[model samples]
Target: MKLARFTEQGRTRIGKIEGDRIVDLSAITGDNHSMRRLLNHYRDWLPALQAATGPMFALSGVTLEAPIADPQKFLGIGMNYRQHAEEARQAGIPIPESQLWFNKQVSCITGPFAGVVKPAVSDKVDYEIELGVVIGQRCRHVKAADAADVIAGYLIVNDVSARDWLQKSPTFTLGKSFDTHGPIGPWLTTADEIADPQDLQMSLYVNGERRQHWRTSDMIHTLYQQIEYLSTVMTLEPGDILATGTPSGIGAPTGRFLQVGDVMRLEIDGLGFIENPVIADCAQEVMP
Candidate 1:
């Protein structure tokens, strides 16, 4: 099932995508609250969702929101792609022996088609199209072999960053957490739908120009390995997110950062695509 969160009329609702329309789960039963809760108890909801009937809405008419906006641990992996790491290495940044993790404040979450606010404080805003993994159950010390069981689903994520603020700290939190910097979703495709997570293709484009193109197989450490490494350090709870990492072609390497009115379109093989228009300092949005 393709799970999503969206706004129709004036209220936020959760639903399952059925071609060009979405069947509102809330209209079916009062038990469903949010996408995060549905995922936390996927086994129950998974079967229940098949019976969902609702006041449906056309996909184009409603406002799309981030699939799971309330994740507690919004984390990102740095330079996990070997090709991207090689680019960083050439730029004088050492490649990490293990996964380099950072936090992306949950408040930064925005919808797939929403306007991405280019913070007035920095002009070095950059985009990193990443494959986002959302956790289904709380687990720690997860073996890489058992990691697949805890995954709920996946989506396309834009790890928008401000280069100036990123280099100001070692955590990469300050720069990564700016409001509206994290734009994730078109919708979340369940893990069961993905036959091989490591073999999917993902790419990103800025204003019609292709900037990134690579497969998840190019990742230096697989997604399960990342789960194992992170779970060893902290509890991986339901709704927690991990940006599996981005490939090369970020603005930093070419010094071609995002400016107002630029549109970012990211696509992952099974997860679908998300297009977000760049808006300056919250001023206004440009056409998609």
Candidate 2:
């Protein structure tokens, strides 16, 4: 089932998407209308959510919000796609034998149709289209074979970056965590709905031009391995998002950067798509 968080008539509520309509889960969820809450107790609520008969709203009439707005952790893997790693190698970045991860501060989270700000201090903004994995349960020291059990589902992630700021930090946090940088979710496509996570196709388009296109099958490290690798270090909690890396078509390799007014549409086959417009940073703060 596709679970979503949306606002209609000024109130945000949890819903289950059916065709073009959103069936409200308010009565069933009570005051726990957030995706995080539902995901934490997903096993317990699955039956009720499946049998929901609440009032329905046209999907177009509501504004969809980020499926998980306040996740405990938002992390990303770097250069996990074979061709993308090769491209990074050519750009002077070494390929790691183990997984390379970085943090994208939770404040950067934004809705699917929100605007991505082109910071006034930097003009070298770039985009990386990636498959976002949302964790469903808390676990540690998980095995690759057991990873699927902890997964809630998937979504599209546009890992926006500020090239100049990126070079300043080896961790890639500053460049990756800019406000409005992380655009995820039209909604979450539960694991049961997806036959195979690694076989899906994903792509990105800027201003109507195809900038990146690749399949999840091209990933050098599969999603299961990533989960296993991460859980070995720390507890993987529900609502934690793992951006499973982007493919070879990111703008950074060619000097093609995003500018104000450019719209980035990122799509992952079964998970759905998120299109965000690039807008100028209008904040008056002075950059030293």
Tens digit of per-residue lDDT, candidate 2, span 131-209: 9999999899999999999999998888898989988988899999999999999999999999998999988999999
Q: How far is candidate 1 from the true structure (C-alpha RMSD, Å)?
A: 3.2
* Residue ranges of candidate 1 with Cα displaced over 4 Å: 27-33, 282-288
Compare the candidates by TM-score and give the number of the best one: 2
lDDT of 2 at 258: 94
How well does model 2 score by local distance difference test? 0.92
- Writing each residue's lDDT as its tens digit, candidate 1 over 1-288 gives 888998888888888999999998885445445677777667866667877767789998998889988888899999999889999999999998778999999999999999998888897999999999999998999999999999988999999999999999789999999989999999988898999999999989999998999999999989999999999999998989899999999999889999999999999998899999999785464757
Please state the error at residue 285 of candidate 1 in Å.
Answer: 16
Question: Model 1, 204: alpha-carbon shift in Å?
Answer: 0.6
Measured over all alpha carbons after superposition, the RMSD of each candidate to the real structure, in angstroms, is 3.2, 2.0
Report the poorest 10 consecutive residues by lDDT, candidate 1. 27-36
Score residue 159 of candidate 1 by CA lDDT.
98
Model 2 TM: 0.97
